[model samples]
Target: MQILLISCTQTIAVLYRHVLEDSYCLFCSISKQRFTCLMSRKTAEVTL
Candidate 1:
């Protein structure tokens, strides 16, 4: 019974960690895209 409980806890913890990591990665990618877009726009304005 104790083993079952431990396994369940571990599974839940792993899943939670994966969710947090995924969300953080998504946010980082979005910010990176926005940053690149802003930089490109600035360059375009300078060229024009």
Candidate 2:
């Protein structure tokens, strides 16, 4: 059960990342490193 939950959360994160990148790309030019940092921060928030 726990593993399933974790995998689900990770899948959601990946989908969210794709959406975010697409939207962000439309508005501004952000570097890959910055995008990664943003994603890591978002995932950290979700884990907490």
Candidate 3:
């Protein structure tokens, strides 16, 4: 029973880690897109 519990805990930890990493990946992509848009707008303003 103790062994089973240990395995279950490890599985949960791995799942949690995956979720955290996925969220970080999503956040970075969103931030990068926003930064690119802001840069493009600035360039357009300078040209005008």
Candidate 4:
């Protein structure tokens, strides 16, 4: 009874954590791409 409830709670917690982690990874990847693009443009302008 109690064990079943605890297991259910743990499962839900694990799923939520995974979702948050995935979102954070995606956000970082997008930001990193933007940063590099901006950096390259700046470097090109400097060279020119």
Q: Identify the runs in model 4 with alpha carbons over 4 angstroms from their true place.
A: 1-8, 18-48
* Model 2, CA-based lDDT: 0.31
Cα-based lDDT for every prediction: 0.23, 0.31, 0.23, 0.23
Mark the 10 consecutive residues where model 2 has the least summed lDDT: 22-31
Q: Residue 15 of model 1: what lDDT?
A: 45
lDDT, candidate 4, 1-48, per-residue tens: 111111223333334443333221111111221211122122111110
TM-score of 1: 0.20
Instruction: Report the lDDT tens digits of candidate 2 across residue range 1-48.
Output: 112121223444455564444222212112332222133223321221
- Model 1 per-residue lDDT tens digits across residues 1-48: 111111223333334443333221111111221211122122111110
Best by lDDT: 2
> Could you give candidate 3's per-residue lDDT for residues 1-48 as a string of tens digits?
111111223333334443333221111111221211122122111110
Alpha carbon lDDT at 5, candidate 2 = 20
Instruction: Name the runs in model 1 displaced over 4 angstroms.
Output: 1-8, 18-48
lDDT of 1 at 39: 24
**Backbone clash count, each prediction separately:** 0, 0, 0, 0
